[model samples]
Target: MPFADSLSSRSPQIPCSRRQALFGAGAFLGLAACGQPHLDAGEGILRVIGPWDLGGFDPTKSGAMFSRLQIAETLIESDNAGTPLPGLATGWTTSPDGLVWTFRLRPAVLFHDGSTLNAAHTAWALRRAMEPPATLSLAPVADITSQGDDMVIIRLTKPFAPLLHLLSHTSTQIWAPAAFGPNGDVRNVIASGPYRLTRFEPPLRMDTAFFAGHRGGPRSVKGSAYMTVSRMETRTLIAEGRQADLIYSIDAPSARHILADSRNQIIAAQMPRTLILKVNSGNPKLADLRVRRAISLAIDRQGIASGILLDPSLAAGQLFPPMLQGWHDPDLPPLGRNVEQAGDLLSQAGWLREGDGIRRRDDQSLHITLKTYSDRAELPVLAAALQEQLRLVGIAVEVQINNSSDIPLSHRDKTVELALVARNYANFVDPTISVIQDFGRGGGDFGATGWVNRPVEQAIDDLLTHGDPDGRRRRGIAQVLQAELPVIPISWYMERVALSDRVAGGVSFDPYERTLRIADVRLAGGRS
Candidate 1:
């Protein structure tokens, strides 16, 4: 099937003490405008603006920033296709039984702190990542040890194929021993990457400079600056005014505006991300599979893709998008809109239409609260559209726009009825890593809540250990998700970025959005 058809077919309120710090001055301001040309060759600095802020220094919590800035390195990395590539580890080998893996470290690499990259440091970083709060520890890792000063060994409880891919994640980023405090806390973030962090202000701005001792040598750009801008309009303004050289997470409308301007360039690539509605199946009203399917059938994915997203081809028919080749099941029937069927299913599930048009079972009404945030720009708009669509089927939805943390907090407390989120399935190149986190035995914060299927869990485990070559087990998992409607797949996504013409060389967009490739970026013309 053609790629297009494949996709088409188918506030939380902190205390008073936190208020002053979060809303302080200089928090939302863009960097000072350079008096020189936008891209001064002599003073090579790439200014960037994005939706996410510098939450902290912990790789496990805020690794995306570190990874994107090239201020940190992971033992493994992934290519565009999600295949494992080399990073800190030059190469790796596994034993015959596949339980023990050995990685050969690259030589002569130096951390930003002037510490040499060695096996002991690599092992310490990996071990730290496997501790609590770091999801990497969730993997079947049994132990970690170093061989001499150049090799690191990882012993796994079983043969897990996604281990390498998991290492590529930001959580497993290697840091120097000095980066941690006496108690092993992440007091600093010194690492061996192309860039080194010079200044960091939590939740807002970060500054970095090219590392002289970097393995790839000094970058053409002497330094770079990153600022967190929550408003999409502000990001567009910076891109258009050339106040910033690069801007990420552009909405469809902003993308169109940027594309029309000659001074800016828009780069977009289909990503392995799916916009989904996480459902709490434990709710008495949502406990029935038929009711869940009714809600899924009520969604007009085609309309949302074409009308809201302005990209009809992005309509998702399954949980996994076409970008994830193996997990996307071409054989399954495409998800379609059927209002009559949906109403009938709800009726069969003990819902009766009242005079006000709202369905009800006994004295309870078919009312649900959907939690979403506005940072992404599209999410709140999508939530409004979803509210309208669900109302058509005798369902009344109350949309709550809150902090991104609220969704997970609600999920943990089992109070969330529905949540709209953009789930990235390519965090590890392999879908299994995200799959296990979101849909494993116990439901995940962004995954299912109060929904469990033993067979589905077993299938995911089988894929992790045996590898889904034919994708039979993968299809099975998708089938299970489709039938149960633990999460409703709304639309696939395309990552969009706006670049100023001042950037001489082109910037590479990682489908996973892991790296910004600032090192390769230089002034449009030669040195001034």
Candidate 2:
């Protein structure tokens, strides 16, 4: 009686319905349909390729693998277009007041271990994530109670417009209670995903198997094997040898070299991540608004973006990217390369050029340390470019490359002079939460100089806590943040994923990096 069986019984071998087929092919019918998919259970592993090693399987402590890797599924889900859809919850409805939400569970759906997925199980998972240790943001339920039979009602203290987006995130992923130990700690992951974890070795490889219990449409890749090759050269080698079905994280030159081979396919995606310079505006040396404006003017964003990143359009003029539609205002004044204006501003601010040609104030020379990291591969190069560009403006800067985590740690210690790091703004579908978390008073993990404008802060709070459609207050807040430039952007980054021409029917990229739906991805048999 379940929808899965109803759909399955009608056509077990077909992946799409007549409506879908018509939409895709415009009513054209094939002379002969494809045969039943022959999946060899022993060799049924679909090899997936990525960069990070599968170190942590637990979804709470480390969710990179759990969320990005799609090793688990959340109650509510999002389509490739980022539209809110259903996962474990077949359907949902809200009260007129919009404070309460009730979701209906899919019938007869079972976990990999053959346990039925019910309202009780779903509620338990939500409760666990809401507890102190996990502190998941999406678990906004003050209380959750099962409905008469198959439904679950969630009561929230307030209406959260982005709650559905939070549900699609990894922290809300559902897991069998038995997957954890008596201490309520996760030791393993027995989840309901397109792929299930079969073999895992810490900091190295993760091999996944197709879930036989999956009741979704036909998938091309029934199974997949994921392995991490850290060294860029090694990753290239793997792709060259066909040892890796797909390769990622290689530099521009390396990617170009790999793409030259006729046997491989290279895919480039505009990653919703921005490379920014974080400054401490509160520091007396940097407090003067003129100093901030002068430094912003001095940095040649176009030169750095093109010369160092090999992309001209990546040069940023504002804090947020064009892809972040709602918050980004195209009407703002353009930031361009202006060395003469920078020099004039510094001179007017009383920072005169001394005999040594370095700008000086009293006995102090204009020198500072710029901290960066080599992890992302391009940052150190950009840092070097920045060093040269800043020095040209009579500002002496020294560069240091450390671990990726050092940026935030240094910010907390107040030891960081200026930090150059990449931020992925697409983590949350709605940009408001990220903006608030980063720019609010005390600042969140990634912001610098504790940038706080009371008006901007209040505007964001109004949008998050209480704001209706056509919220001019939210727009005003974004405009203020843009004008102030809490975090100065150097360039917007694009992530590259290299795949062997053997794979087909896979979506290009999802900015959230959530799931790569491989069902339609089939191994190319030399030709389409």
Candidate 3:
């Protein structure tokens, strides 16, 4: 049978296991136990389960936990639409040339160590972030100095517009001076957010207590615990057993099963993340634009989104999702499946169909290796779907499931042929920052490998310095990417959260995945 015909006859099924079934059943029993719960506010501590683990104490390395738990603060904050908002710095101003920026610190703020947060501490943190092993140093910074006890001044080598957004990143999170050792290394995790670290377990668990001295006042919840559970089944069991108050990144099927129980609430929001196929444009066979477009045309994004993800709306029409204001162009041509068109494009690219239906040019077979990881549950499944879809178009794809680090490692070593990854565009509020980081000069590990578009690079440079809120320049960049197919976007992302009814107060979901909003949570039924 022809590959296309065989694939058409069979329906795509989401792979499941016995463990999933057992844990899914356990989730129902856990939900049932919540009905009789009347635990006092002091007796209950909010428990959180998520995939992110505490890598280390360095703000440049593992400060995401501190930021998410509100144990640290950055110089700037962002709104839902990626606009700059007030944070540790109440307000900021820039010089006419945009080279000099001044930030006014929030008054009377106390760190977890009881030291007042001042401009000197902030300047030291910024300087540390701009040093070795810290990714924040990639920003266009000239100098960081303190004006007084409550003000910080920054000088830029050039007019970098994403400076504020870069400051808002987790790596730039400010720490107390006491947190560092004599060598300027981060020896402790002292910070100035609403929560203070009380217990620290490297890479697995952390316990924190609400800080009374926080400038925002005490949080509604007295204390909280975070546990890193890599297995989806274990996380589901924890959520079902009511041992955990909140769980992040639940699978679509597990979410559906848990949502059947009224005691549990599933809060899902669209995030500015894209499931993309990172191609090695440097490869001999893939360097051709026709071959790249053909491979992209072979993907059934709608099928994968609707079948595996259980949400057809998640199908990506363009490189940028709708959440990214100006970058997502509605008028751009949408990516669609066309087997005949894919075959013709391959023929035009000099790929001849062989006896076994695999395409060949000269002695090289139309074969490629796809690298993906199992950390994100959907990725492997999506890789399988993509492999079969590409086979139908006479392109033989071998899917290699490996560690998440392998993708970037292979990219650096020039061993990556194709990689499937979830790229977060709003890491710094401004999508252009991530765009430049990924697609600029040498090409990012998660972006284009062997190709560079001068127009896209120039537009990104302009967007960073001049800003492009109107999106005219952003549209051109997107158009260039669409035409070049440096990275093929398959689906947008939906962040899933499971909250038990025992917890009250609202959870604010940041589309950027910056903060977890644990401070706002309180015991249900007004127990506080």
Candidate 4:
């Protein structure tokens, strides 16, 4: 049952009238006037605007870049409904022993450079992903080889039930062999997706054009331009003024404002994420289970969810949200604020409240730095709220808002006392992969403090190696791990996407907030 065994694994559009006419503008513009934007020659190009900066074209490094994701297609893909479907590997089957998997590549599929999709090329991508000097966070393959012209076989040291889900991540996306240099470094950046990257601007914007020769032939979308505008007001203005065809990463207040406007239509969906505090359980002051339980009891999740989040449904009753149907236990006792009880627990633990309103044990004040990042636009606010909440229970907390990478950096340095983060459990459609990275051994960027649980590890391994599709046993194992206080989840997150009336069909929201069905979207005016 070792944790390693865990199964698992844009806005905007400008109307280009001339471009439309060249394609079919005269006919499509009439329909485009209906606020639908023409899908033919007369229609306009899609201008997408959002908050995620395009770090780079590297799929492993820059997750928010539509430029990268649009070009790179992974082995598996998921819809907004959270169902796992085929991607580059059109079909796959697992060995009865559960240690090997065979993937049947899509025939007639070609990369941007017109390279045929073959087993050898697919194997090259897999092998390159496993090699060092490249950090494709979700690479789980121990080895990969071509079985035939269209079949690629992957070998695993142990069974990983969530393997497919991991493959669905953009970080593990498949790129053409020529895309990388001899050292496995990304060079040409050629991908086999429905769209090809035409231009890339670091940490900001990207432009892509439809790959008509794509296996699926661009599905529904013709072409798209993605922009990274970190400022919320900018995205809002663009959406409202009809400058942007689509937008995302809006805060609750901004979302309400947009939804309130009659002209703009906003779509809000439940994101598979949580606002949780990762406690360093190994710290002497927090090592006691009673202390962790007491801290959990001292917070008012309902108040935070309703008052701060402006969404009462986000108040998390358990570590795992209800959306995670299998791993969440409906029967677990709800953690609620009870200051008196918390005080009593603290007193019993030999901690006494000082005159300054901070708990003291053995001459040490109960003060800790709660680290957070502002990339999400809400973590800092939540951290401030948590600061006041914890203070009510005699715990003094200092909030330090740093860059997103600092959380993992601090964790590695062991300087992090408590880290407030928004963890996305649906990154791979299965919770086990996250469980392993976050809770196993030394803990990943968003897991427990200097704490390790052997029993939880074994349970996860068992579920990965032998659990059934029924998922009950795996659920039980996840619940046991949560009950151990490895990570404390306070509120769940819901995904939100903002769209303009002109943008059509290209809009689908996923739990992880990833752009998966980009092909389904096209310019309002007909120009595909």
Candidate 5:
């Protein structure tokens, strides 16, 4: 994927109240705040504000964003509970041997570029998805071939239970043949979906309109305009002013503030996401299992959840929240703060508290730097709380707030000691794959660094091979994590968005955290 130059078009960017965003001056920002449409985008456009920006034309990079907007789709789609639904691929079947699977495509589907979707093009897209760096590469896919104009067959090295579920990911989104260049690099986004791209400017703005050729609308909305607003403060003002129909990733403080506005409401849902401390286990100070355990024991999850996040139950008892059935084990002991126990553990690890109240083993100090990003709004605050809690146990911490992307970069370069991250396990079909990718073997960008447990690794392989119907394998992995404390779980996440009363169709949330489903909503009193 080469550099994607900025896209220029006549479509308008959704403005903010600050009037100083990359989207330009917000002269028409709060027009809809008064419950009326402005001059340009009309009453039908669903204007949205959020923190994520389009990475590029590369499907592997920014495909999830396209999926969230429903501008492009994958072969298979999933409901809130992860049940497979028909998208481009209407139906599929596995070979009796389980080594091969065939998918039947939906008939008469038209790409945005007026190209017909067939088995060949779909296979090409799937092959691209299997390339390195994409999530699909983790699967056992050997080859993808088109048997005919409508049927596509996938051959795997071995049987994978999550094959269909893997295809549901946006990375497998099929693009029109014309979307690719002669060198096979993705030049643009041209796919079959409910909407078509009207304009796109990387890192800031995107605009869309209903594709009349497809069989989707007369929907509640004709189109949507998205703008990346990184600051929670500016986003809250935009929502309070009704500048956007939907504003995503609102902070806890902003959510409580929005409740006071009768014309607006907070739309909240349980997300399969957990806030954890991404520990650099390779660091000499954190190498000992006792040191890591002491770090976990010192932090108070209950206090942080109640005071900072505003929900006591959100203080995660375990990494797997209750909503994540099969993964969440009730019998496992909950994670609680114990300062005396933490001090004891530190002493056992050869770290003795000195005169300055900071633990040190001779000259080596029990000190660490915690990296965090404000993308989720609660993470920086949580980092601060963790710092104070660790200080009580003579563990000194310095919190450094930086961009979310830096966490992965620092992890790769071995420069990060500890990072505060909110990880979404449901980004894939299930948490099973995520757990493996994160904590398995060599470790993932956001998972355990320089830490490996053979039993945990073996458990993941067992789940992959035999499939954990009773979740015995998953519980075993959890038990090891509870004892080892690779990454300390802080709290579970409830994805909250601030929506105006102007939005209709009940303001339902996509439990999968994929799409906002703007197509489902309309102006309060307007007909669909």
Candidate 6:
């Protein structure tokens, strides 16, 4: 990929008032000029800035970063539409009954440690990945074995249509034999990819260099120094100070803040992730269908998108975003603000308005606590907005800002009344898995807590096994979600990035966040 050299000046979803980066790019540049500690800008090293930190050595833990950086490769890669493509495995096939799958490995591929890629190594990696916590464990994988140097066989207990897509997960990234310790503890990331990990500082910085032995051949930039700057302000400063060539996972405010910089390019892609409000449907107070509908009706998604996200197009009317072509229902009624309807529903649910303006049922107030995190930066603000919005409908919402992990913890403990979550539809490569895992019999931590519609679950199940060519089953899943209001759709997500002018890029925004495709980025004056 050629580095970013001739990028056009694009406006953010919400244009900043030419505040000249109201946060002060001049101050950052001045500090850099004053010998403040800044980032790298060498020709050989592409300075990459983002919010993600290296979670750990395990793929199931945080291997997504390795794959995103092109430091690791999955057996099956995915296209923008989430279709399977050749990766470590050139091609693959299944038995007539779909019970057995065989993958023909790409030959002569060398790991960063100089070890050759083989089926035995790949099989070992897959088997290890089947351990709990990885989505692969969800599949009914009966056994895994290596036949020859290039062939790996996997037998399943039953036919699983999502097996291919499951393999596309970051947890399934093939690893070198030496990547793990004798007891199978992952010690390093030694995988066959365009980039290899040369330096890793847990939960913060990762430095990678291009591997000459990569099957893709030589890369444009010799390497990349990825730094995890969690603060949006600092990330904006890095983009303006020319400290980094590529900045990933930026927010709308940061995007708007840096939009005035003509020297860089703004890359915004609608992702498969959606910001949703997860409600505890099992809670006695929120279990009523009318109350749930009231909660949905009271939401002002358009106002949130425009005022907070600064992008009205990012407002979500349904559970699935437009990015998921088949899952998003075009004809289904969209969720919107209807204060009267919300109040009516609440009244029907036996909650009458009281003097405090909070609805009361038999002297019990219609009050709920909403939990959110600040990782995304917008969630806490959105939570506050939701609090105010619900207040108008005679519902009292208490906002609590906590760590991201607390949501799941509270879900498991059956203690959460409401939670603001950003659910990623492409987590399992196929969107159907999201429906199953989230709304299935057991339910997901970030999904509808204690809510299970057997018919919708079966519809999702049949979509995989029986095939839904007519999309009737898919539409049923969407309809059930819309009607049930198990998860209130708020806004869709956008992957915002700023590419520096020092390089020219043949860049593509990966909706799946599968790969950064840094390989195509090269020096501005370098050969194509």
Clashes of each: 2, 6, 1, 46, 0, 14
- Residue 349 in candidate 5, Cα distance off native in Å: 2.0
lDDT of 4: 0.70
C-alpha lDDT score of every prediction, in listed order:
0.82, 0.68, 0.83, 0.70, 0.80, 0.83
Q: Model 5: which residue pairs collide? A: none
Q: Over the stretch 1-528, how does candidate 5's per-residue lDDT look in tens digits?
A: 111111122223233344444333242344346443332355678878888878898887788778778788888888777788888988999888788999999998999988899999889889988888887898898899998899999998887777777888878888899999988898888988888888888887788888888867577678888878777766776776777777888766667665555556676766788999988888999989888989888989999988888778789888888877788889999989899999999999899999999999978998899999977768888888899999999999999999889988998888889999998888887788889878998787788888879989988887776677887888898888888888889999876787666676446677666677766776665422
TM-score of each: 0.90, 0.86, 0.92, 0.86, 0.90, 0.92
Residue 59, candidate 1: alpha-carbon lDDT = 91
Question: In lDDT terms, how accurate is model 1?
Answer: 0.82
Which stretches of model 6 miss by more than 4 angstroms?
1-36, 526-528
- Span of 10 residues, lowest total lDDT, candidate 2: 1-10
Error of 2 at 168 (Å): 1.3
In angstroms, what RMSD does candidate 6 have relative to the true structure? 3.8
Question: Weakest 10 consecutive residues, lDDT, candidate 6?
Answer: 1-10
Candidate 1, 75-187: lDDT as tens digits: 88887788888888999999998899999998888988898889987898888888876867767899999999999999999988788888888888999989999887888
Off by over 4 Å in 2: 1-44, 132-135, 138-141, 471-474, 526-528
Error of 6 at 502 (Å): 1.5
Residue 151's lDDT within candidate 2 is 87
C-alpha lDDT of residue 35 in model 6: 70
The candidate 4 region of ten consecutive residues with least summed lDDT is 1-10
**Given candidate 3, what's the lDDT at residue 15?**
41
Prediction 1 TM-score vs. true: 0.90
Model 1 poorest ten-residue lDDT run: 2-11
